[model samples]
Target chain A: MTTAQPLIQARGLVKRFSGFTAVNAIDVAVRAGEAFGFLGPNGAGKSSTMRMIGCVSPPSGGELRILGMDPVRDGPAIRARLGVCPQLDTLDPELTVRENLITYARYFGIPRRVARLRAAELLDFVQLSERADSKVEPLSGGMKRRLTIARALVNEPEIVLLDEPTTGLDPQARHLVWERLFQLKQQGVTLVLTTHYMDEAEQLCDRLVVMDGGRIVAEGSPRVLIEQHSTREVVELRFAGESQEPFVSKLEQLGERVEVLPDRILLYVPDGDAAVVEVTALGLHPLNVLVRRSGLEDVFLHLTGRTLID
Target chain B: MTQLAARRARPGPARVPALAVLQYHLVGYRRTWRGGALSSFLLPTLTVLGFGVGVGAYIDQGVDGVSYLEWIVGGLLASTALQVAIAESTWPVYSSLQWTKIYFAQHAAPLRVADIVAGQLAFVLLRVLTSAAVFLLVTGVLGALRSPWAVLALPVAALLGLAVAAPTFAYAATASSDSWLALLFRFAVIPMTLFAGVFFPVESLPVGLRWLAYATPLWHAVDLSRAATLGTAPVWSVTGHLLYLAAWAAGGWLLAHRALRRRLVV
Candidate 1:
């Protein structure tokens, strides 16, 4: 089998729920051995697209293939070669932490003896071996999340799908999960993940697509998309108790573009430090001023004009 | 088959999708089987003792030409099977669908919806058959079972379990709350078990209600079990009762498949 074929290919993929369309016609192909991401806000159809690729939900209208097989006809066969970590933790509370892994493995028809050995190794990999016998109900959220990730790998799937892997994790836990995912990428595991956190996307994804309102707004490597959509640097000026709308025109000359927010004005500039000096020379005094490099958050905002949460 | 089962790794068709998922339930059951032990065995023992001895002494001649103990043993076993099956299906199915989302996890694996449903119902049948077997043993020691054919109740109980539980699984898959399950037990389970010739003959009920008992899956099981234990002829032929139970199980399975697909597959 040649590796040139895309592991997953979709053309004009669409998903509609009753009268409302959740995912519009969009084309995407995930290559083998690459870390791909779906970056979007809450209702941007990222999860819907992920579901279709995962072979759990059928596309309403499109040509889709996974492992070169029709998902609807060969779902079980395709799923046997996939590892999926859903958005929510679906760990079995009644079973112990280790039993959760072993039991889930049995679903893939992994023999009991082999399942036990793999479960042991996976528990250790997730750093939950010490809590092997502990019931799942008592574990912390991070522990449960790690166990869920470990559970997905029991079959040694060709492609792993993770849906918002660290949405509600603490910063430390988030870093731990990201580190584990990066190691998987290093090991040549094909990964397709969805996240609203730009840092998560930047840390894990080799290339990603930004989705907004059921459509792909931009697609490229994180660096490429950032360069394409947002300025290299940004200047923020916060004024006290004002809409910052009145100062929009006053700072227009300091940067290529000026965007106003509820409490601050942003000057999209090539160089933030240079823009700050020009702002001061222009006689624009604000309560607080800060300068920073533009990132994926800026790219998302520039393309959609709405914050990730909203 | 025995060698294949003994071996730890038997791939291919040996790993039937239903069997794979059933194996999961068995593993989980090992940790919590104690929680159900008391009710599974003790309740059957006590019910047989109390009703067979305590209530039977008051009546000089038992109904249907047999002692009350022999007469009720079949009904008791059938109803226990019904209760075991329904009890297993309700809360567990609801929790897996809505709370733990176990079905979604399983559906993500290589198992199909039919396999998951069949595997769960198989677990229910296991509980039903084992509990009914224990009751049969207790009644046999007590000399309440008169014929060797009484062992046939074991299979009858299993059939009853699937017939009722498959439909209950469909209901539980989409039920929003345990209160709905509670309402099912209160309005359906209690009334059906009570009136389906478990406590008394359905012939004594009014004309309209007699048909209700005949229509219930539990009554079919009770009739078959009661016939075997009393060494008497059943209300219908042996094939007739089995066919009816088979129909319920098949129909329930179709509904369950539809509900599971709707709920699990987005």
Candidate 2:
């Protein structure tokens, strides 16, 4: 092992359930203090890959390591140092919010006195100190997610795995979860998360792998991936008198690439204003025009041939 | 050798888990006290009053020559023990697996599947033992105890409860849906209660149905308790009955562990 070896490493990791393959020979490596993300659509094997890294599910065949130890052989020891927030909320409803933290700490063999102090601190860190005595069932979605995060941190884990940390929450709830995750990232905790939301991946992940059909299609920093796959600017034009098809051929020569949507046409050009002026000179009467910088969503669409939301 | 030494340095399996499971039982017992206490006390109480007092007023004590109240008290204790075991083992176990997700929460920690099963069985056995103790005390207050041999009935009832609870827990863990549990209560528990000689002697039933009584754990428990309480020996050896219950408990525990390990670990 090298001195700069990654905290987590998997080589040709394959996980299959019966005849169905969930993760098909994927290789991944995550270093310390780096926020990594797995961006994919549903059933794209993101959660399965996270579970294997969390040491909860054994890989069907792979060379997997966590904290420089084998996951299959040293799961308990590796789990002791790693925190996992699963895709679903598995908080104990029977326990109070504080008790949930303490009970989880106990699972890692943390002493009761230390666990209590840690629970109090973590509750405060999650901004849930006011509701520490409340049962988990009555808490809102955001509070439950925060408590799950707090529970994962009880052992002072070196690496925290969050699977779709803000999938179903409202905007406010998602922002709160994102802010807390940002703080963890600032504290130098190695965060590995999976999210289908491109904005979430861009905001939270320093490096990410876009997965589809049980394989990694692209991997890099969000900005690097976007720059590599998509142009800097895109111009959108909608026609009034004719369908978008007629304008696609007319606009194709003005930009490096032209993509036709059902209602609008996109011209991916180095300069948005020049593309818009060139489009207006074509004598095509358009209903609307828009120019914006390219984003991770555009990169995802370009690679996957489908929008993230669709 | 180093690994063995490290293993030995850790606490015994029985110590920390016993405390955790004990705490879990206390919480569960508090939650279900209203329903659990009523069912445990009411069924035996009603049977003693309805059959032992009401029906006993009409007929003389038969071949065994024990008072009707005294005779039925042993059966009541035995059946109550079985009921407590069945209640703890079936729906609660199923709910823990499916709805409550309590077992998953527990297993996420240092607690192994064996710890969970052991804790659950231990809690159920404790509940049955406590209920049996209370029932036996009430039976004594009602002057149902004919001899000191009645004292042996408490442990016997607990063992009988384990005999039923252990295997039932194994079955409950393997069930993927709640409908199977409904069937168990409907076809198994209800029929066993009615025909297991709880309210009356099984010998009075037709020979064809008598075999069904013999098949039930409660019947063997009741026969053993009745023999102990009335000082009349049973047809089967007490060792045989104890061994039969032990076999069921052991087999059930093994099966439950296997099923739970397969489900949770994979």
Candidate 3:
């Protein structure tokens, strides 16, 4: 097969559940060996779109092609080549950690001997070799998540789909998972992940689409998106005795645009220090001040008027 | 793309492996031994001991020329086999469809839904045959088999059980929930057991009730088993009884295959 064709392509995709539209018309194309991400808030149709690409749920309308084949007509055949890690771990609780990988490999028609060898290698890769024989019910949450990722790789799939890979984890566990994902990326495996964390998107994805209300409001690399939707630096200000209403009028001349949040007001400017000096010259007594570089969180909040963390 | 299409098109007759279905039934049997085996053996033993000795002193051996103990033994063997087949076919089949998801696991492979239903029926057939063997041996100790033909009745009784169980499995697979199946057992199984001549002769019923016995699958099973044991069936030949059971088995199997394919594959 030629490398010119993309591994996944969707044109004007639409998905509906009952009478409610979950995912409206959207376009997406993912090429081979590229790390892509779907960045959105909760209930933003990220998982629904991932399910369509995974060939588990049929689309309501529009065209979807996976591995250059139709997703609906060739679901089983397409699923054989793609791996899926759902938001919730669906690992067989009755089986041991090693058996989980072996059984999943068998479902993809892998031979028994190869399945056993692959299970052993994946257990070591996920750093669970010593706990291979233990049942899944006794494992910690992080261990179960790692095992789910291991099961997804058992068939040696060309593309792996992960839905909210690190939604619920401590900092240490999240870093451990990110390190393993980086290793997979270095091996030239294509990855598609959905995450609400702006840092996760900035750290992992080469390019992404910011979705809100079932539509892609913006699409670009993290750096490109920040440059397009926001200034390079942002200055935050909190008033001590005065309301932000007077400061919003006084700080109008300092930056390109001003965003008034409930607690503090943000000044979008090319240089945060220059904006802070101009704000102090206006005879404003602020309780707290912070200057930092802009990120995807700023871009997300600017386009959708909704904070990603909330 | 064209090359991959050609690779998928090169196919002969698709066959599901037999061992996968064998593993499925073994897993099920390991989970529910009392429902499948223990009750099948114990229920008939209790009936034999309870009725054969407790009530045998009051009822006299009639002009048919067989003792009361011998007369009731064939009916008990047939009832035991039927009960085992019914239990395996109904709730277990419903659970596999809705709760356990074992069929989904099997169907994700090369195995089709039809292969699953066939494998389940085959497993139930084996269980019924084993239960029939044990019951027949107990009846033999009780001296219920007066002729050499009673030995051949083992396979006959098993085929009779399959006749009833296969159709019941077809009905069970179409059930939507557990409550629906509870209704089926309450309304269908209990009534069939009482009126199907399992405990007494169908002639003892009134004329209207006698016609109801003619439509039941178990009545034919009991009649054939009793005829084999005591040589008392005066109307239907052995060939006739065998043909009737064969019709229900074949028809029910086809219906089950179609129903399961429609519900699962899409």
Candidate 4:
């Protein structure tokens, strides 16, 4: 690595809400010009961690330094250089789409003329120029999310923090947002994001940490985490049954590991086709069988338990 | 990096942080000011015409040796300021804090909680001042201005605005829902307007109620405002009235600061 200092540094960071510990001690470091991610299920304290990093929530313990300044005291200065897009849309309902950008820019002390030009530029960037004069309440969800993202870029912030950027969008809208975020990454803006979608992590994060129960269970590049936690390939078997538990013991020795779900059985092995052959030799006639490469989803299942997290 | 270079080269002016947040309120008002304008001008005009001039002709000897029309004008000015301040404070402040959550968005920016509160409170004061100015003119046109000191009522009205608006800001920030806000107006604001020397002198009330009125911010504002228009001495010393109003503002600001931080910083 180069001698450049990390943009954000945290050691044993903790956040508590009343008597409950939402975020337990966690360590993290985000370097400049690289995309970092927090991958977790809901209630994993990823948003709490992002809130502390955003300087809106004070840490209950440990140390946090964003841009080499204490977030507790130097919040305004740190926030001046940071842009945040929260999970929910918080756009101003009174103003038009374009006015939202201009007014938000002024919060950074941007001059009105500069603010106006930057707003127009950002509107074009987000492809919301045609709806510049429209009220915020009437925009579609995807449009509003894009506008919020544009608002986050009003100051051309050094770092952009996105908390589940595309959690509730359709596939087309998700791709559009993902594509825009990818372009920002290519432009060398440091991006810190949190998501439950393994595909999102794989698509955008150069490096990431998996959080479970307010703790970082694993941290590495996406490929590295997948490689360390899962096999090269997976064999998925779906039999004609409501539950796949009955076939678990029968297929246990055919692969490195066998996992049974509500509808399917997953076999972790070096070669998925060889595992399927072994399954056939075991006198198991499956209704459906498919071979696929292991992904971050499998890695998360291996790290966390099998019980579903909503 | 190029964007950073361009920003440095531009070398923008030193920005006052509160003014930046206030710009949002101002921009929003540009679209909604028409609705507010109608109420500020029309409320006092109708009250003066129907209640002041139209009804004063029936009071046998008038009030305190002056025409009843001129007698109630100053109190009405104070009342108008209180109404304007509270109107701007309750629903809009609660909306920004909870419903729209625009204040949370502002909190995410490079602004302190003080800046957000001060900026919006300043806008409320502006509303109070402009509405008071219009009220002064409407009453003046209807033969209510008896002395040159009548203009002082504008500043007195703004002070009263801060006295009421700041505390209401705290309530809005901390309230769980608009139902609490409805109860506040029904219990607090309505009672103050009726009992605090706005429609009649507090001295005419029972001793217990009179003392209660004396403790209200509106009573101090009304007394000072009456002295301003009638060229008469206020019931309390000028410094005492000013101090009482200023103390409420300071205390309310502290409460609002705490309330806003609690709501937004979490």
Candidate 5:
């Protein structure tokens, strides 16, 4: 509830497993009622960081505080006030969809009658009320994910930790999940999530950290990151050729920077139309051309030297 | 309850919130209880009919001054508790830890690793008590129960469950594969149940094998339960049997807590 102090604060946080360090010393802070994110590719230690924040995995080094309380000493107290939706569903297969929520609520010591009401409300909120009695085994991946998200809210937690909220869902399912998450944000629930999808981070995060190889590489609002790291517009040139390598040198002087991919050449420029005009004046003909505004994907690519998805 | 309140006041690793975990398991048990109920009732009935009536026809002289039905019935009740306890501790514990990952789910909440382990062990004891109570009732109807002290077998059965479950929970938590459980049942559990003086006197075995049986938790449970049912416990070293069973229960719980912490808290 306090704005001056962050709900979660970590300084030089580290997580080491046996001989390998999954998360190197990193600093992070998440204030109340804001949606924060950790965005990165696989093996980037995003999940490990999320696990540490959820208080399930102990930090091998550094200091962590949740609700201004030490993680090691006040884990249960802190966890009681936090909701965690793990990367996997972890739903009980034997219990019905409703029972999953109710049972999880009971773990937090919610009274039976109150738990029943909350389960019903969450079922409706997740749009799973129709299938409330059905076993979780029959639900689709999207439905299960939504139920997981719903389950996370059962405690009416001060902060919700979502690890890869929508990794495997189809576009429509992902949109529905995003919409519900947006609703939670509108209701002023603090959310910290991890995801590899640039669009998901762009869509949901108020501020995010870009992680790679157990360290924070960059941190900012998506717009600020894009503005700072990438150009305003981009022109993608795909030629009917065996390789895009030769065209990269020819297109270099036309834009601020040129990146060559297997199938296309991207020109980062202040203006897409000017870049396209320059490309045309160079006497190089492209099979197809696309001019678009820059996004977080471009920022990630610009900062990390790799495509966000690949 | 006071311990829980005290933990809530100043929570740490030394004290885990247990009631919440117990409530979670109770909710999970709601749907699965029916299947467990059938086995709890049917296994005892069949064992009594098959081993008590069919096998008892051959032995005119009861083994311990009682009918063969009465002698074996008490042992069967104790073994029933052991079976229920081990069954709950093995596949269900493994499935919760590995397959369903329910333990991880609880770990994400206010519950600690110790709470999850203790709550599950308590649930196993609840199940063992239920099955043993039903088996005791059947034994009574069959005229196998001889003394008023037979009522004490219910709690004794729960103690047996604790003895078996603590160690089995630890093993299941640490096992890497479900196949290991099959091997455990075949080599360890089945052998213990068969030769733990359940069907015949352990004295009939060779001296070395008899001492080996004496070391098992199930043998102690059977010995104590049979004595209680037949009013023969006062004649033996009852304190020693109770102490031995208590040792297994206490030691098993500590080992199980460590194993669960290794698996879930990490």
Candidate 6:
């Protein structure tokens, strides 16, 4: 949490593919022993940024420093301290689970004995020790992701980069992964992850940036971002057999903002209970109503005018 | 935690990272090497028995002062190594890049694109040399090694293997579909093996076709191998063959590095 020195720093970083610009000039910095996240939907250049930080892709322009070293000249040296879990599972399918970690550790020149011990410990950390001898191909999606996470920890890296660590997992699977990552964070391993799941960001990221169209639109803690961009509460109203768009004019001034979605109209207000009372006073008899605290999803929708997952 | 402290207190010394990349493939190969054992030993033995002894019995006057069994034995040895090298370079390299994504995993680690390409070439060399070793053993069992100098063919086969594999590795990395690899085998690898003096002397072909075989890497390999096994190599010009093969290996490595960098490094 010390700002005197950051573990990763980028200034005006850019990435372009052929004629298409994937990441525009943007700046970011992350401190040691903290969890930072890039929150964006697909095609927002989240994975591209992760690749640059991982030292697998050279930045097309601008300056990026990881561990206070240039990426191009010192990629190998930098990567030695990085553990990257790519969006897709790139585990060696032919090798068994334990072999995958042992082999990966060998790439870092870790001695065989140490690699074996670390692989065992990491397997236990990820709770995959019982399946250590199983082939990676037949494992469930959750198991594969856990294995990938465990593989990333083989080097005991200073910073672990996870690109959409829980993209395709079931709810239960994601929670298990989140728990393991939380443990890593508790152990003082800095984690940088990209996820479109707002709940995930809220649960795991101590601080994050919301990216849209390859640009960072906002940066803050999940709670701070939500409070900055949205109200303290949200009131959802759904009128049966109504277009819902017509109610926008009626509900516009009821709160700070009104958002009309396909099935519901959301009112951003300081107090959801007061907003509901005000709505009834206006004689808007709604078929359904729900009041909930605002979250990162509201912040994202407010900034981008699009859902994060969409 | 202790290991983490150890790595932090003293990072490992810098070494050629390609060897680590090579170790990855070799470790995977350990599980699959048994599957290849049957083919590596069986195919060459069959080729020697089917053509060297079965067909050579018909040619009363051996093709070159030696028995046809001995003449074809050396050529088959070189072609076998070339085939093994090209085979290793094609689908396995392609799958590692595309399907299996082993190179992506490696690239995400500390290794560079050049290290990945070099490691793949090294693995191909291991395969070619392994097959060559077994080929040499079979030759010895069949009494094909006429001179003690025949041991030199093993290293010669290694050079030939690199010459063929390096460029194929570049092609595999850049290819969009696996279909093109099938064409490489059918048009390039098969023709070089069958027509590059492995089955018969290139001098017997039509003049236009003779030059084509002379230009092939397999032909140079066969010439060197035949000379080593027969002890009839021209002493003054052997360096020329070695240099030519070296040129192929060096050039192919450069192209593979470029292609792999483009694909993996973005």
Worst 10 residues of 4 chain A by lDDT: A301-310
What would you estimate as the lDDT of candidate 4? 0.90
lDDT of each: 0.88, 0.81, 0.77, 0.90, 0.86, 0.89
Number of clashes recorded per candidate: 0, 0, 0, 0, 0, 0
- Overall local distance difference test of candidate 2: 0.81
- The lowest-lDDT stretch of 10 consecutive residues in candidate 5 chain A is A301-310
Interface RMSD of the candidates, in order: 3.7, 6.1, 6.8, 3.0, 5.6, 2.2
Ten contiguous residues minimizing lDDT sum, candidate 2 chain B: B6-15
lDDT tens readout by residue for model 4, A96-137: 999999889888888777778888988898889999999999
DockQ scores of all models, one per candidate: 0.50, 0.27, 0.14, 0.57, 0.45, 0.59
lDDT accuracy of residue B42 in candidate 1: 84
Q: Is candidate 1 or candidate 2 better by lDDT?
A: 1
Tens digits of per-residue lDDT for model 1, A80-184: 889999999999998899888887887887777877878888888888999999999999888888999999888878899999999899999988889888988
Best of the candidates, lDDT = 4
Candidate 6 structure quality by residue, lDDT tens digits, B74-136: 889999989899999999989988997888988888887888888888989999998999999
Native interface contact recovery, all models = 0.56, 0.16, 0.02, 0.61, 0.59, 0.59
Q: Runs in model 6 with CA error above 4 Å? A: A1-3, A306-310, B1-14, B234-236
Model 3, B1-60: lDDT tens digits are: 754453333221123444446544654465456664666567656777787666666778
**Model 3 per-residue lDDT at A56:** 54
Runs in model 1 deviating more than 4 A are: A306-310, B1-14
- Candidate 2 C-alpha lDDT tens digits along A99-157: 77875666665656667778898999999999998888899988999998998888778
Off by over 4 Å in 4: A1-3, A306-310, B1-14
Identify the superior model by DockQ, candidate 3 or candidate 5: 5
Per-residue lDDT value at A145 in model 6: 94
